[model samples]
Target: MRSAPFLGLSVAATLSGCAVPEARLRAGLIDAGLPQPIAACMADRMVDRLSLAQLMRIADLPKATASESVPQFLRRVRALGDLEILGVATSSAAACA
Candidate 1:
């Protein structure tokens, strides 16, 4: 039996959506302890390959949403205010999901 070489490509393409540019953000979010599910949603949301600058932009975003006792970095993320952090969270979710 023969299989389509690209059969696996669809998933690769789907994840390729933003796999590279979003690497840093993903790492950061993982470190931040953001729940896995929400993080996956954000990473899957990104479609285009980002420039290093754009990746930095995503990396620059915050992680922690609210509730002080959570963590300092999370609070910093909330204070800074950047939705891209969701990408980070999303990536983590992808890992566990």
Candidate 2:
């Protein structure tokens, strides 16, 4: 006896946390020592729903293990390789923007 709409809403809420808001993502980057402007760049790209790998690359995140959580992924992105451009992803993700 679960309603379909309720299930849908539940899914959306769960996914929203995984997706996160652009502002929060930016703040995380700055707190992690990444430049603040990159947040805007990443948010601009996010206008399109990017793949998980694409987001990781744009944010300069590392590959995660089975034990990793969504926040863990964000943390890795914040590390950001100490570079503004993150060195073009070195074959990770696609060239497509």
- For every candidate in turn, the CA RMSD to the true structure comes to 7.8, 10.9
> Distance (Å) between predicted and true CA of 66, model 2?
34
Q: Candidate 1: where are CA atoms >4 Å away?
A: 1-17, 46-54, 57-75, 81-97
Q: Model 2, which residues run further than 4 Å from truth?
A: 1-5, 21-38, 41-44, 47-49, 61-97
Q: What TM-score does each of the candidates earn? A: 0.37, 0.33
Using lDDT as the measure, the top candidate is 1
Best-performing candidate as measured by TM-score: 1
Worst 10 residues of 1 by lDDT: 66-75
lDDT of each: 0.49, 0.46
- Model 2, residue 78: C-alpha shift (Å): 18
| Predicted candidate 2, C-alpha RMSD | 10.9
